[model samples]
Target: MNWIILILAGLFEVAFAFCLGKAKETTGNEMYFWYAGFLAALSISMGLLIKATQTLPIGTAYAVWTGIGAVGTVLVGIWVFKEPAGFLRLLFLTTLIGSIIGLKAVSSH
Candidate 1:
């Protein structure tokens, strides 16, 4: 389904962000490799987003896509990059997840 595609696209967006983070922490060939991964993930994410938009409303799809990317990137930052996971941050993340669900539920498609 397009929703599944959209979700996958969002995941790729997170992957691209992860790649960028990793690239930032590395050097030389390793940095270049991470940048390559970023490019690949970015390409796939955009492609799937374009596909999903064929069936889903553009506004809803974009919001959900970015929401998923934001949530996933934050979690990745906490788990992988050892970033802060304070109370307020988690609270906002929960709300964002709820909003994404609400958007899906209210979508005409």
Candidate 2:
């Protein structure tokens, strides 16, 4: 269950990051709403990650969270915003995933 929660928290981290990217282009009243939402999601996700770290090693959990969030966000940015989707970008993303899994496995002991 903790792992599940941690994964969800990481997903939320990605979501908030996406929201921030969008909000960066805006500067009116609507921007504040997006900023507020981003802040709330970021804070809650970080708190959840901290709670999850009670059972998981900090390095392993943080790596997983950051890796997933960054990869997911970049993927979304490409699909949703038509950002660059080059082979090198995907290769690096794959490497991030591999390293995250390796770190988690090694730290699980």
What lDDT does the true structure give each of the candidates? Answer: 1.00, 0.85
1-109 per-residue lDDT for model 2 (tens digits): 6677778788989889878987987899889988998998899899889888889878778888888798889888998778998999889988998997787678753
* TM-score of candidate 2 against the unseen true structure: 0.89
Candidate 2: stretches off by over 4 Å: none
Best by lDDT: 1
lDDT of 1 at 84: 100
Model 2 global lDDT (CA atoms, 0 to 1)? 0.85
In model 1, where do residues sit more than 4 Å from their true spots?
none
**Model 2 pairs in collision:** none
